[model samples]
Target chain A: MTRPDPESRRNPPGAHLGAGGSAYAFLFFPMAILTVFVLAPTIIGLGLSFFEWKGGPLWTGAGGWNLPTFVGLQHYRSLLSDPDIRHGLINTIAFVVGSVPISVLVAFVLAVAVNSPWFRGKALVRTLLFMPTIVSIVAVGFVWRWVLNDSAGILNWFLSLLGYNDPPNWLADGYWPLFWIVVVQIWRQIGFCLVLYLAALQAVSPSLYEAAAIDGATRLGSVRHITWPMVAPMTAFLMVTGVISALQVFDLVFIMTGENETRYTTVLNLEIFREFSYGSFGYAAAIGVLIFVITIAATALQLAAFGTRHPKAAGRAAK
Target chain B: MSREHRRRAANTFNRPPFAVRLASHIVVYTVAATMLIPFLWMVLTSLKTSGEANTPPSLSNLLPATPQWSNYATAWNVGGHVSLLDFYINSFMVAAITTVLAVAHNALAGFAFSKMRFRGKAPLFWATLLTMMLPAQVFFIFAYVLCSWIGYIDNIQALVVPFLASGFGVFYMRQAVTAVPDDLIDAGRVDGMHSFDIFWTIVRPIVWPGITALAIFTFMNSWNSFFWPLLVVDSMKMKTLPLAVADLASAAYFTDYPTTMAAATLLVLPLVILFFFMQRAFTQGIAMTGLKE
Candidate 1:
């Protein structure tokens, strides 16, 4: 047998570059834009967290806002004590903790059911499930708002017909506002998660199921022993992304709950918007930092818990 | 047993039982119907007259006695200070331009990371990936301040500029580009093609599917973006489709459900149409974003 070329083994053909300048040339534009837009703002946000800037711009010229005063964690300290911020933090956490697991589980089940060979019209089902994800959140908010409206809403009307005189006012009552918001969030999100789960499910080998079936394992037993473990990485991916977006929940709250209902609907992003609108820029930046911290910590915790293996890695290894 | 009988028995065991199939189909259709109810209601209500839409507690009110085709016209022309046409134009322009710029920038960066050799490439790539994990709200306040300082506040550029370089886009493109065969790049290099030339001529065509996926994702995201547009655009003339639809929904103290539904139906119609035509691409793009290789 002929041996493989050691030179080819050591250095892949495309791995070699004639000069370093070409690499920098390709990278310069994106790096510059990201640095300016994403990186600089992040660093500036962190710096802004320590300073107090009222009025308008930070300049001292005519028509300029007051100079930024160095407050050195004062904003952070006050945020810890602010009732509204505290409430906002709790609401944000509740939204994440409440929605992520439920959506993931629902998505997983749907994916499994759809992936079964006997399941018919799978494409149509997948499209219908994913329809909400493509629509604007604002549209979703409007549609659901009408659907859940107390007096003239379809849900309440259906409830009344069922012999209940009054159904709980979904968007108006205490706790129900948050409840409906989470429902809407999950509703929009399930499609995305379902598609992901389906992809992961498709990648799951059917041979494993055939083997399990030959061993006299029931469908539930096979799914429990094989499907659940196989889709763990996708679950982690969903969990981290879900928590990050949930922590930054704003559009649903803004459109669903509307203004002056912050007591029930305020999340950290809404709190930031409220503060920014009130010209509390520094305080808003502080809240922004807090959100950043919470997202990072939550993501880190998820990664630690689930291990950072890509689902596709398993597919590749199987091949 | 004989060979034919054994084969038939194996087939019987392979297929699910009739009861199981019935149960699964029942659950699946119910879930699909539940998922579709809001969309059905939105379309139904858009055809409803204002009175019918606001009518209290009646199954008859669910569908209009006569379709209110006028609601669409009214929603287009007189619903808000800026008509739905202007909002469509604004949304299209912003989303289109942002998609173009983001794709170009991310593709370039992806090409470099995937095909080139350079010092500090790993760190630079990791840095970009790190930003993906941070929520946009974390940097958006300072971004707002930056926009104001740059005189972009209340301007369309405010909606477009901050999104021109997306970390997710860069990461996605890098993954796609890395999967391109190295032999192709070498052949292009042997033909004396510059790296950019190779990227343009060879790599891009090879990775066109990835680019299409990214484009769909970016376009949908930009079109549906609400928070940044809401924060930056205070004027009536500058609102995107989402901001405009939201404004219409909240206008008139939320009394005009039909017109609001009309506005919403218009806003979502294009995407739904696009999704139907490109269901495979849409689902693939979504799944690609979620489960990175």
Candidate 2:
């Protein structure tokens, strides 16, 4: 019996010996699923934005469901005129603009403090800080709802003890609902940003800080000169991702406000849900398309502002 | 300010001022404590009787006079039409199946992207990466329509199927797979192992850490998924834990604080425990997903 060479055995007559062909075989399932679930729906959403679906699916008594009626640019025009959606857009922007900077700054401070050499039990502190991020957002919203209740909430209780007789209704009051929602969002998200900043901070070479100190720089000076510049890319990354997630914020606001109080906390996503529930599928798709466009534009802006290359690894060698 | 200067400076200035260190400690611990307040309150409120939970604002109201352990039972049994156990089963089934499928499919695709040469590989990978930038809400309207057309509305498949492939998972796994040395793959090929066989035996084991990270992430995200499940599932029988919790907190039962807290506690405790054991993996997974190269 002649032993076949390894290459011949690997590349048998019908086998996919070429790497490119084998890659196709490996990629077929995931690509198919992505196309159907993500890509196809995105395109369908764009198309649906032009057509009006006034009611739930009508069975045509034939084989299939009826298509929505076509009304080009009407939903888009209506979106511009709708006060609720206009407020929703403002609320969404308010959330992103309000939460991102506060969360990032607090997280940066926490990261710097926790990353200090003298900080004991750093792991424990980090874990405690990050605990909120792991909990379900709906649960967090509910818990916060109770905590922010005017009469019964512990926060109010504490405030009352501090000599304030009337504590504002954090979740129910005008504008306060949105304010508390942003606060809860920042609370939940700060840990994630802190962890990322910590990683980036640790990746910064100690010699840079040491060198700055030797040059008669203060701790704050060294942090400003060395640490901040080194972590700028991570900051840029966080800002972009943060703003995107914040723009799409739904769960916390929805669960906290319970789909009512549209005047206070209706975000763009909640508006989409409302439109969909009302069988305004076309309008919802239009809003969805708007969100997609804004997300892409924001991402493009970040890439333009920060450049594509991350300075993470490069910052280490500069020391 | 060079290395020699730094050595001298470090020897002379080895320690920071005590006040500054104390300030750092105070700042870190204060934030940590504030971060922990909600969790602490949840656990405490879960132990409170309904009356105590609803009591007027006072210092003593913060703690239950008598811990009502039965709140858990009530929350699990009588608080909702669907039993909490059923919700757990549904949640676990959806999350478990979704995690398995996501990890497996993502790992296979990541391996292809990293190890195998392919035409359009660059463009295809960038397309998939671009999908990560597209928020899930962008797909919500049409995903709902698609599910309705397919008759999956009010069905668990609506929750599980759309999420079976994650772009973030693929991106993270591809990064992990790229770190696997080429020599190892060549050696596996030399042994006449097929690509799938090589992936199962070699690549999978080498990237188990990444797989573990992705699995935890997928499970957590699926288990905590609120928006899509809310949109798709309307039947009480099909409600995931998050949806059920939301329902429990809504108008009909929002005033029932103990039962709601108990439900919240039940919803949170598992992930908390999971995070406890897998703390490093959990944090690393978040960093990996967010701070990709």
Poorest stretch of ten by lDDT in candidate 1 chain A: A310-319
The TM-scores, one per candidate, come to 0.93, 0.92
Tell me the DockQ of each model, to 2 decimals.
0.56, 0.49
lDDT of 2 by residue, B130-204 (tens): 777665765667777778878889987898888888778788889999888766787787788888888899889
Residue pair clashes in candidate 1: none
**Backbone Cα, N, C clashes tallied per candidate:** 0, 0
Question: Which numbered prediction scores highest in TM-score against the true structure?
Answer: 1
lDDT of 2 by residue, A1-319 (tens): 5677787566553233245377788788788778788888787778888998854466867647776899999999998999988899899989988999899989998888787766788899889989888899988988888888766788877777788878777777789999988998899888989999988886776667666666787777666667777888889889988887888888888888866856668889988888888988889889988887887787798887677444543454255
Q: Give a tens-digit lDDT track for model 1, residues A126-173.
A: 999999888888898889988998777878877787888767878887
Q: Which ranges of candidate 1 are over 4 A from the true structure? A: A1-12, A15-20, A63-65, A308-319, B1-14, B79-81, B291-293
TM-score of chain B of each: 0.92, 0.91
Q: Residue B115 CA error for candidate 2 (Å)? A: 0.9
